[model samples]
Target chain A: MILEGLARLGRSGLGTLERLGRAHLLLAGMVLGIGAVLRRPGLLIAQLFNIGVLSMLIIGVSGLFVGMVLGLQGYYVLAQFGAAESLGVMVAASLVRELGPVVTALLVAGRAGSALTAEIGLMKATEQLSGLEMMAVDPVRRILTPRFFGGVLAMPLLAAMFSAVGVLGGYFVGVGLLGVDSGSFWSQMQSKVDFHEDIVNGVIKSVVFGVVVTWIALFQGHDSVPTSEGVSRATTRSVVHAALAVLGLDFVLTALMFGE
Target chain B: MMGMGKQRGIEILVGLFMAVGFVALFFLAMQVSNLSAAVNSDGYQLTARFSNVGSLKARSPVSMAGVRVGRVEAVSFDKDTYEAVVTMRIDAATDTIPDDTFANIFTAGLLGEQYVALEPGGSMEYLRDGDEIAHTQSALILEQMIGQFLFSKAGGD
Candidate 1:
């Protein structure tokens, strides 16, 4: 009997995977279509406000400390070589290229992704999703699409802000407290950063991360059974999956971007 | 119904606060970028040649006498000469670099950023644009430096 049950579970798992794969493709297409439509300036503006602007407080405060720590650590290492002025360039480049987007994505995954999963799960449990479907409305297009776009739009802007704040934090420590010349710090940063590529790459990474986080959350929420226990499970899975996806995607993007 | 209304109001307020904060932060970032640009404008220009570019990057500062006078503008490899050519923009107000000046690539700290430092020479001829500073040193990677330092210390012991 145990053997039979295990076999049944295996078959069900495969069936679920197949279903999820198909659902993912459909969802992807829908998300892309909705994203294109929402790219309209007015809608984008609303989304930017919802996703990017609102996330600044957490990003900023965290970024400040990140920058300070980077400055402190970078300064110590550079001091040994009597080359401390390069601290500005080091801090700026690292913040722009890697730290900014990765950190912001992780933070968003924790806060927004979890909330989205839980909210959707609760709505599903309360039969709202079913009600919408019965009314001939596509839940994926109406509910998931808006959230997916919002998250995708917000990640980059928030990441950029975090990086900027981080750099400022480094500046505060390097110039104000550490006695490194402020002029040197800023000049070094401007020289090192290729505003076009580095900044754009950061933004692009954030958008991708945002989409991934939203998709994972929605997927988990939609699949959840209509029970409180199921909702809790979905919430936990969404957060875990979103965080891992962020880190994994970051690595892949970095490898692709800097491979040459 | 009243409880739900109050909860919704709180959510809206939180959202509004986030929006306001983002705008304020973005404005601040723009100001910082402007300030950095202004600072860069005050620096001078200098050029150097290296055999290897390694991880050297532009916007890396050029310091002399513990003061930053310039930053790297461009990095390119000279195929014919088999050298890495780095052009730097120096602050106009700074004193001129002499002919025999030595350019050394150094780090800001351990695992920190790399930069070029110019040690001025007492030569009569001053460097001009397009003129290359003859003596140049490449960046000393941290691992290599630490390894050497440890080896030498152990050898002495």
Candidate 2:
């Protein structure tokens, strides 16, 4: 019984290692395929519309709600210390440094990343990828690469919009509703949040997330078995795995960027 | 449903999305953060040495007469003198501060962050890059004040 269990553990460990190696290879291939996709910009533009423009409504709505919640909660907490005037600083700082990129990435993983996986997986199930291969067209270059570039290019923009809307949301709640002085709300935020340190770092985080989330989605879809059940499973796995990867990478990035 | 006109519309929508994204980033960099702050523009460096800095850090405001004139660029320890050497970047426009100006650390509000406040002197020569302020006062520590008070009371008794 002990020997059997040990064998099973070793097999699973090797299986995970194999998956990691395959994912790295896919990443390398995608990097090379970028030139191909760039040669035909229209493909990338179409994917951008599907990935970025479609995701905007959800990102903006969530950002506004999240910011409003932060303002409400921060007011109560800081009011106890008689520092409620720092509401703008608190809201902008938290949104820019932590919530903006991370939340946008999670939402994108759920919204766009899964859709990419499903579409690609369905194409695989229908042998469309093989059909392209038979015609001497590389699916990774013609299809996956464009989608990958779209996600990477779209992520930072979505994160930026989320943060800007979030700050406005906080302003509406803190100044308009909570009676905090309007001048202090904006001035304090301008003084406290450094552009290079906070906003640039947030953009960097979003770009990294875009690369990671889209890569996982593509790899999972490509690796899935060519069946309906397999496509569904790949879609589910892509979301779960991308989310976990994002959260884990976020902790490491935050520690590196913000830790003293 | 996927016609040439629809294709053109999609491309236009994508272009609009990218434009909006750039605007959002501009808003974040320009309005939300301190990108347009005077500290980022051309400046001259000045050094001040304090016996104790006490929570003063890089990027803290360096103000003259309650108006921000520069920012603390770096803080380092001078092992030979056991003092904290602070580097400040004074804005080029505020170049009239005299060489003998006194630099004192002050807290903005109760339990708020500390900043370097400058008191101008009557000296004709102005401070330039690499100039060191002659007079300096360190951050006040509450514990030191209480200790001095107790010692004075014991001496009176």
Candidate 3:
């Protein structure tokens, strides 16, 4: 029984690896097709609207809450040191450096990622993908390309919104609630945060996460079996995989960005 | 999946969102990396050496009486003395520094950055082009001090 269990473990591990390989191939192709999306700007715009603007309300609301939390936590910690004025610096740096991009990506994956997966999965299950192919349509270019571009374009913007709102939330909590000197909060934040290092690096991280999460969602949907149960399972998998990928990629990017 | 009018609205919304994002980015750059203090200012070079620099880096502020007068241009180790040598670029507008001025490597605030604090000397003549600050003090490393404190406490016990 022990030997059988070991064999089962090895088999499952190999199977998971093989599945990952196929998904990698699919992601590469999906990314390459993004260039073609530019030629069909209308489709790109459509997908951008469907993906980007639709996620704004949730992004803004969550950003405020996250920022407030940071401000509260940072103020309490800093207050013990008698340096509550630096709360702005702490909040801005934390949001711009890490939380803003990562949390935005998580939310985007949960919302738009699942939607993208379900849309594609449903299309696949309904034989619409095959129908498109029968009509001499390159389904990848017609469907997947625009969605990929849209996600990549929207991610940085969403992250920016998150950062901006987070800063405001920090302000409300730190300055308004905690009575940290408003002037020092702003000045200290300005003095400490580097434009290239903090903000731009964050934008870059969000862009990378956006592409990855979108790729995962699309790949899972494309590879799913054509059935109702399969489509729902793919949708769930897309959200979970994209979230994990966002977190994993975030760790690597953080290390690389600040390792110097 | 909507009609033509809705598509136009979505496009408009996307454009507005992108605009807001770019504005936020611009604000971040301007606010965080404030070049207003260092704009178009030609400067003179000055040098100082220290036994320790702590976390001081190039571009660290050189402040005079709580005001930023210049920035550290480069930080290097002297081959012979085995000391940290810091090069500073002082603003041309403020060229009245005396040669006897003491350059102290002190940290700003409790947990803030290490900076060069200039304490002026009582001298008739002003310092000029590529002068070395003869009076220098090294950075106070916190960890070393903490270790010393612990050791002293243990010995006392």
Candidate 4:
């Protein structure tokens, strides 16, 4: 009896492994099929609009507010040490190195990622994915490729917007609102922030986050059970998973890139 | 379904967004950082050595007479000499620096930021490209000084 139970446990474990492996294969297939889909720029552009431009207002507004807040908090703390002149360096470094890419990724994962999962999940539930497959049109190529490339391409651009706006916002608050010297605010930031070290790393972070978030979104949508409830559940799962994945990957990437 | 006009509109918006994105990035590189010092100014290079650079980095200003004249271009270490080699890009217009000018790493606001402050000497000769600022004052870290001070006081007591 124990032998039989052990055999059953091993079989189920193997089954779970096969399912996970199959999911990876599906993602790989979608990745390989990008060349065929990318020939059509119209689809890619439309998806880019959906993923990035639609996110413009929220990212821009939040970026400004967050930057202002950073300025205020940074000034108060820096002033206590009588180093208010270095407030610009503090704000810019904090935003570019840590806040800008990570926060932008989290926001994008919430808005664009969830929308993608829902759209793709609904299509799968409605048999549209299979319908395309039946017509000999590869759904992964036609459906997934554009969204993946769009998300990946748009992410760095959005992150740059967030950083730029945040920096400006900090400038307004620190220099305009507060009594910090305008010259020092601008010069200190210029002197302290390294283009290669801080800015380029931030872009790399956003691009990595974009790829991972979209991959999770597309995979969860395509893998969910074919029902309305299943689609909704997958959509919810996509947002949660994408957020966690972005944060976790941010930590790992930070350790690898900046740690030592 | 969205109409063709609407789809094209969205594409145009994305295009505009990207254009602005580049502009913003340019502003950051040019105005908010010293990355554009290469393209924006014609400058000659100089080198200085220090025992400690502290937080001094590339693009830190090299000021003379309380006016900004140039920027630090690169920094490296001479392992054999056990000293830091700092390369500076002095603007072509500000080429009157004396050969005997002393370069001191000055801490702004009692330890906020560090820059090389150039104090000119009475020497008639001017420094040229590849000329070394033989005199350099390394950064004074507060923690190390405090540790030394505490140790000396305790020993004295």
Candidate 5:
């Protein structure tokens, strides 16, 4: 009798996992499709403003320090070979490919993603979402779409800022302080990096990361139980999930892009 | 209600500050990209003959007297001559390089990028465009340099 019960529970657990996977795919498809149709000048402008402008201070400050560190580390290794001029190429490539998108997404996930969860969780606890439904308003379109689009739009601009600042920091250390020739620095960068593909790829990754992070936050928040403790739990879960999603997606994208 | 309104106002102000900060950062990136592009056009050309191109890429600067005058524009092998000919573009404003200027392929640092350095000669005439720099030195490959240094030290010991 115990063995039968255990088998039943195992079957049910597998069934639940399958259903959860299907539901996630359905949600992703719906959000992406709706986002495509709803793309508009006003909506985009609002999203850009929320994501890019409002989050710039944090992103810029962090990026500046990251750039400085990359320069310092790259110099330590490269100076052994007397190849310091290549610092520009190293700095530019690292910023554009790995650091820019990943760092910006992580930052946004921590700051905006957490705030989004808290706000939505509070609304759920207060039954505000139910009130919207009673008033004949589409909560998905009205509430979730704006925040989702806002994050998606903000990510690319922030990543670009990070890349640029990182390069500048590298230049300050590699050229200005170390006395490496400026001409050599710029030449190495231009020759090695393809601006079109590398820059565009980074931007695209940021957009996808933004969507994933915002959706996870909103999903967790909207489903929270109607209690103070539930709201707090939801907020914490949203941040943890969003951060993990960003990291996992980054690895997947990198493999797809750079993997031979 | 007044206190709530004040809190909301503060939030809006913080948001506005973030937006302005992003705009400034974007402009900064644009400026740097422009600066790098402009600096690339200011150098002169010198042809270097090399047995192995290795990591030596085009747009690689050619330096002389510790100043960059041109960039490596193209690299091709002459089938009949059996020599690797690298064409470079020198800055117009710079003084003409003497015909006997020796070209040597050297690296920026130990593991850094490779560039061709020209040592100017005291000859009267200048090298015209398309003129092959006759006195050329090949790149001192890292392995060879290290091996030679080690072998000499070991022989002394």
Candidate 6:
């Protein structure tokens, strides 16, 4: 029984390794597929509409609420120490350093990523990908490249939008509603948050997340069985795996970027 | 899967989305971060040596008459002198500061962050880049002051 358990563990471990290798192969194909997107930019723009514009409302609303909550919580926490004037800096720093990119990536992974996997998996299920291949059109170039680049290009901008909106939300809560001095609120944040250190790093994190999330979504769809149930399973797996990857990579990235 | 007109509409909406995203990035860089508020790029550097910097760090404000004139660019240690060497970047716009200005570290409030305050001196010569301030006062540690107070009380007995 113990030997059987060990064998099962080894089999699962090997299966993970195999999947990792296949994901890298798909990544290479995607990289090579960029030429097709560059040749016809309209395809990429269409995918951008689906991936980015569609995701904006959720990103903006969530960002505003998150920032408002941060402001409210930060004010009360700092008030206990008579440091309420520092609320803007607190809110901006936390949002820029951690929340903005991370939350935006999480939202995109759930919104666009799942949809991407579902769409691609369904295409494969319906033999659409096979049809394109039979016609001598590379599905990876014709279909996958635009969608992948769309996610990659959209991520940093979405993260920036989230952070900007969130900062405004914090300002509204802290200065407009909570009686904090507006000058101190903005000036304090401006003085404390460095553009290169905070803002740029957050953008970098979001871009990395975009690449990773999109890569996972595309690979899962391409690798799924050509059936309805397989497409559904691949869609669910894309989200769960992308979320865990984002959170895990966040810790590693924070350590590298800000760890002293 | 859509007609040409519908496709063009999507392209327009995508263009709008891209424009809005760029605007948001601009807002982050300008208002949320200190990209626009940095000291002038053509600023000159001045150095000062202190016995103790306490919790003073690089990027701390350097002010004259409670108005910020520059920023602390770097904080290093002088191995030979056993002192802290601070490098400051003062805006070229404020080029009239005297050579004999005194640099002193002060806290904002009780248990607040430390900053360097400059007291100008009367001199015909103005400080230039690489010039070192002659007079410097280090940051005051509250615990050391309390310890000295207790020591003085015991000594009085």
> What docking tier does model 3 reach?
medium
Off by over 4 Å in 4: A1-16, B38-42, B50-59, B73-84, B135-157
What is the DockQ score, from 0 to 1, of model 2? 0.89
Error of model 2, residue A49, in angstroms: 0.5
Model 1 stretches astray by more than 4 angstroms: A1-16, A32-54, B1-157
How much DockQ does model 4 earn? 0.66
**Deviation from truth (RMSD, Å), model 4:** 3.2
Note the DockQ of each predicted structure: 0.11, 0.89, 0.57, 0.66, 0.13, 0.89
After superposition on all C-alphas, the RMSD of every candidate to the true structure, in Å, is 6.9, 1.7, 3.7, 3.2, 6.1, 1.6
Fnat of model 5, as a fraction: 0.06
Worst window of 10 by summed lDDT in candidate 4 chain A: A29-38
Which tens-of-lDDT digit does each residue in B23-103 have in candidate 6? 998888889888886735579999999999999998899999999999999999999999999999998888988999999
Candidate 5 lDDT tens digits, A28-100: 6536656543754344445555556667788878888888888889988878977777788788888878899
lDDT of each: 0.76, 0.93, 0.88, 0.87, 0.75, 0.92
Worst ten in a row by lDDT for model 3 chain A: A26-35
How many angstroms is residue A31 displaced in model 1 relative to the true structure, after the best TM-score fit? 2.1
Candidate 2 scores a C-alpha RMSD against the true structure in Å of 1.7
TM-score of chain B of 1: 0.67
| lDDT tens digits by residue: candidate 1, A1-260 | 99999999999999989868965874676566675546544444454455555566788899999999999999999889777788888888798789988999888878777877888899899999989999997777666676677777677767877887888899998888998888778765665565545666766787788788878887788777779999999999898988898898889999988775
Better of 4 and 6 by DockQ: 6
Cα deviation in Å at residue B56, candidate 1?
Answer: 8.0
TM-score of chain B of each: 0.67, 0.93, 0.75, 0.76, 0.67, 0.95
The TM-scores, one per candidate, come to: 0.66, 0.96, 0.88, 0.88, 0.66, 0.97
Pitting candidate 1 against candidate 4, the one with the higher DockQ is 4
Deviation in Å, model 1, residue A242 alpha carbon: 0.7
Sum up the clashes in candidate 6: 0
Global CA lDDT computed for model 6? 0.92
Compose the digit string of candidate 4's lDDT tens values, residues A60-164: 998899999999999999899888988899888888878888999889988899999999999998999999999999899899989988898888888888988
Per-residue lDDT of B124-143 in model 5, one digit per residue for the tens?
89987667788888887888
Report the error of model 2 at residue A188, Å: 2.0
TM-score of chain A of 4: 0.93
Query: What is the per-residue lDDT of model 2 for residues A1-260, given as tens digits with 9 covering 90 to 100?
Result: 99999999999999999999998988888889989887999999998998999999999999999999999999999999999989999999999988999999999999999999999999999999999999999998888999999999999999999999999999999998999999888878988999989999999999999999999999999988899999999999999999999999999999999888
